[model samples]
Target: MMKNIILITLLAGFGFNLNAQPLAPDFTVTDSDGVEHQLYQDYLNQGKTVVIDLFFTYCPPCIALAPTLEDFYESWGGGTGDVEFIGLSIMNDDFNSDCAQFKIDHDVSYPMVGIDGGAIPAVQPYYSGDWGPFEGVPTFVVIHPDGTVDFDPSNGVYDGPGVTGLLEEAIRETGARKPYHLTGTVTMPGGNAIGSFDLNIEGELYSPGQMLPGGLFELDILLRPDSTYEISAVKSGSYNEGLTTFDMIKIRKHVLGIDNFQEPWKYLAADANSSGGISTADLIQLTKLVLAVSDNLPNNDPWGFIKTDYLFASPANPYEEAYQGDARTYMF
Candidate 1:
């Protein structure tokens, strides 16, 4: 019983260690003007509070919240150092120029970005709930000035009193006092015209109809820099079913350190080969791998590939005695 308990505890610890979300990744996306924009370096880093809402132009709840979100933006978006509101329009087969026109007809004043292709994963996390099973429209997420997720609503419509109150609370917490420099462009895989599409970023929708051309087919967004973002595109038409492309994006303020750290190996390295942290026990395990005397090397090791491409030069020499001893000494 004690041995089983220890095994279970060790497994639980490993699982938790494996599930950490890496430091946010950054990305660059284009806007309606075909200009490139960086998420984190341009907007979030500029000291402006950001409110990102996701929606489809044709979605009833999204449309209903449009005017309300606009009203909030008018009230809070202007003036120096105030909250910045952005809408990301999830563009799919049903999203087109007509949908954009509908947004214009409704008088939405904020900028909207459109996603092209099937990049749903890019923006799924922003909507809250079980990301893999998101089932709500007009999901909202607020990013604090410091670039951490402040509010993420799972299931519900915006424009409700509760949502408004949450928005207000987010604004109070951000307390940003600087205007954001916004810019970005929309593009297709081959630079082909994205005939009538919507781009959803985070939880906001950017409809082309509200802009100059009846349906601004492509989009690019700019905001405070170093902000995390998700972008996706949807296109719809008669003969073809709707298609979407999703991608998670982060706009970085500076270059990041690149290291080839793979799992299992990294986990083992972290544990110094012992069941836990680096210690004398880990040294014993390292010796086993080195002498090919242990069954620790699984045939289909996920971490093995990662280690080969990153830390070590070859699979045959995955763990050198010197390297193992060094890692165990330092990591512990």
Candidate 2:
């Protein structure tokens, strides 16, 4: 939803409608090391968020977003760190020496794939086979750690800040669950039961739903078993600006790449009203929390809001405050 409406003179075109799937389709892609990684198992399942930038080198916007994308990669690391950024040149002219030099000049630290063809499919298999001609450049997709495509490239991420905000939401969702067990039944369109159907929760697959002798049968799963919730909570009374209401406004500024701070986590942390985004309303609530007028935020006290990373690019963390940036300083 944080996408920009920019119809630039692109070298390529894309038209695809990707929705949130029960499980993100699988595909193998190799980075510079020639080590192929299964999009879901290798990264998403391992607690690494994914950002795939589909672009053409000739396009000015594509070239422009390159450095910002690199910053995003370093800001949130892959797997252990937080995010995995991949840049694919989806152009007709092969991504040869010229394209390679372009990346070098841009200082892109993430992996690049999809070269030598006007076609693309190996990356997002869900939309790979019969989706579209995909007539556009500088598009992107954000896959959550749970292997769900929160924002598919079909919708198109118009800019760096837009993509950055998407990544922050994915990271926040990762910290909300640690695989708690719950059960449910799968039914078909009619009154009949869809027995023995495999159940998927938070990306991971479960055994087929059991078929009982008499009437009702159910399946249970441990949700997000692989998720390591980095941001635990954004509570009140934290001296740290990143964790406190101070970062709330800072997050708004960062969404537009303003001020000295630029991060996806801040965007998620600033959404105090739980309205699905940070706005002036969240700032008002943050003001109350800071002034002791309120004890709880609408979206506060959850495991998802507590971002393990800090505002600045350094080792310093939050003080011993209940809802601060430093995960180490957490008491609750």
**The candidate that achieves the highest TM-score relative to the unseen native structure:** 2
lDDT of 2: 0.48
Model 2 bad stretches (over 4 Å) = 1-22, 78-80, 96-99, 116-119, 123-135, 153-157, 174-332
Worst 10 residues of 1 by lDDT: 1-10
lDDT of 1 by residue, 1-332 (tens): 00000000000000001122232234354433344445577667776666666666677777776666676676564423456555555555433344346558778755455564222333555444332234566766566556665435423535566677666655655555422322222322222233444444465666544332322232323432334444333333321111111100000100121332232243333233333333334434434444446535222121111111133344233455224432211110
Look at candidate 2 and tell me the lDDT of residue 301.
Answer: 36
TM-score list, all predictions: 0.40, 0.42
Query: Model 2: per-residue lDDT, tens digit, 1-332?
Result: 12101110101010223453455566666544344667777877776667677766678887887777676565553323556666666655645444566777888766666454212455445345343344467666666676666544434666778866665555455452222323332222123432343332333445634555331444332223334322111112332222454455465575455763334433444556546555577677776666667656655532232222224333122122213334322221
Per-residue error for 276 in candidate 2, Å, reads 46
